[model samples]
Target: MSGLPAYSLPCQSERATLVSALLLLLSWLATPALAQDLGTNGPTYAIAEPHLLRDLQHRLQAKQASGELDTLMARSRERAIASVRDPQPIEGVAATRTPRTFYYDPTFTLDRNVLDAQGQLLFAAGTRLNPLDVVSLSSHLLFFDGRDSRQRDQARRLIAHYEGRVKPILVAGAYLDLMQAWRRPVYFDQHGRLTRQFGVTQVPALVSQDGARLRIDELETTQ
Candidate 1:
């Protein structure tokens, strides 16, 4: 009260209330703008401008012309071919079989008889022959991955050694053109039936009959 001037309490209170309302309104309006800037809805992306697209196309053309992609493909093919050729062999595995023995009367009446052109009885019906006298037909079935060059060469050499008596079974390759070009009778595994039957785990394998069972040899190929 000595030399200072003071506002009324009502006036002061009104000014403070007005300032608080202005701050709240400003904050509410700024919330949405800040959210948009921070990309809360999702990232705001700019499309590649015309010049940028042209630049990318030009770079792609340059790479193709430099044969970089071709070189990579060739290397990939070579690695795949090498992997097929040099397969690891499993040890101490042999073809398994179930043995069954049955006996029947040696004498039986024939339901019908078969005769040859010369009126000779070729086989009489119900004629039982001795099992010991039966001969089992056996052959060599060579398994190979025909995609690899080394395996194919090894197969060719083996076929020549066996005088083409080896039956070529392709386990994991489909090169019909190459088969035709090489003039080889190549057969497919057809859902891996032969591989399972002979217990073959590797490529360039040789399956042959050994007495009553089969012997599987997984061959290693050189470069």
Candidate 2:
């Protein structure tokens, strides 16, 4: 009863048009279908068909015998591992030459309405919202190129200085290798999404939540 309001009744002319449409539809449904007898159109033959699955299975078997399937599988696995081990570096980001500090306001505009379980609108479309209002950063993000030895050392120093309250995010080089060596989670920007979002353009940068804003410190690493 509380779902939606009832629609208003149609006018006299609308009612008459609706009745005429209904009558025509009923007449069409009640009438039987007609077909003209057109015999001897083409020559008939017995069904002779090959099973699709069987053909596919035979092709697979041939591929397996020739070791082509294994080679393809190996190549696919290698490509997957290579992508994870060494992803494309974040563009327009590099080592910090000069120590600079800036703040980023984490305000974003919603493109679509956010709804709850009951379909009630929580936030309307085009509403500008600051994410810091909802949740604060758990820890400081330390972005450094893993390929550079000095930057890697700088990241280690930062992690120790922050007492493990800093996340090491790699913008370049193998993240899996670092994860294995560090014995903790080493995150990669994965196509520069995080760097782009944070507007980070330099390495040895520390991102920490400063009240309602994010404070980014791009520090130069010591030799």
Candidate 3:
């Protein structure tokens, strides 16, 4: 009653479900003008909605109870190669050993594209790589969340393991804050698309892809 209005409160277990349902109702009840505003203004407008506020509060409680935003990220790595007969061939020596790395930040707003101030574009997702050409990406790195100790450690270890074989790892997890939290787009999105692709339901998952196949590796938390 003190924190929230005394209404028909559901059990804690039902928070996400309830929140989801409330959102649906809110959408159904929303005026065309309000819906248009939502499309233009994005989530900022949605936050002020009565039902959205309540749903957000419930979601906060759920997040706290569930521990940190403990979810696995999509980890994928691949090498670029050239071939005559077998285009995008999966069989190669360096390709089998070396993995292409990415240094990404969903929050990063470049004056231009993902490229640096010097004017170089970042590697596009799903870029093709060859085994012998792995050295080309040696100066590049991958960006991932590093806020949690568990996640940081796992990411660090992965980078170290791949160092020399790759560039110095860039940890972007430390930069996560409330404003950018929602904007924090992981390799996966909500509703479990890429999350399912990588089977990521926990923190510290690694993803690697060969020209022919994809592989995901998760870190084990230490007790």
- Candidate No. with top lDDT: 2
TM-score against truth, every candidate = 0.40, 0.67, 0.26
For residue 127, model 3's alpha carbon misses the true position, in angstroms, by 21
Per-residue accuracy of model 3 over 1-223 as CA lDDT, tens digit each: 3787667877886786555544544543464653334344434534455686766667655654674222200111111121211123111111112333322212222343345588677755444444423322232232233444554455446556876232212122223231154342322132334444433444344555443333444445432
Model 1's TM-score against the true structure: 0.40
The residue ranges of model 2 lying beyond 4 angstroms of the native Cα positions read: 1-59, 111-126
Collision pairs in model 2: none
Which candidate number has the best TM-score?
A: 2
How would the candidate models be sorted by TM-score, starting from the highest? 2, 1, 3
**How many clashes does the backbone of model 2 have?**
0
lDDT of 2 by residue, 5-24 (tens): 89999999968754544444
Model 2 TM-score, all chains together: 0.67
Off by over 4 Å in 3: 1-147, 164-193
Backbone clash pairs for candidate 1 read none
Give the least accurate 10-residue stretch of model 3, judged by summed lDDT.
72-81
Per-model C-alpha RMSD: 27.9, 19.4, 20.3
lDDT measured at residue 189 in model 1 versus the true structure, 0 to 100? 72
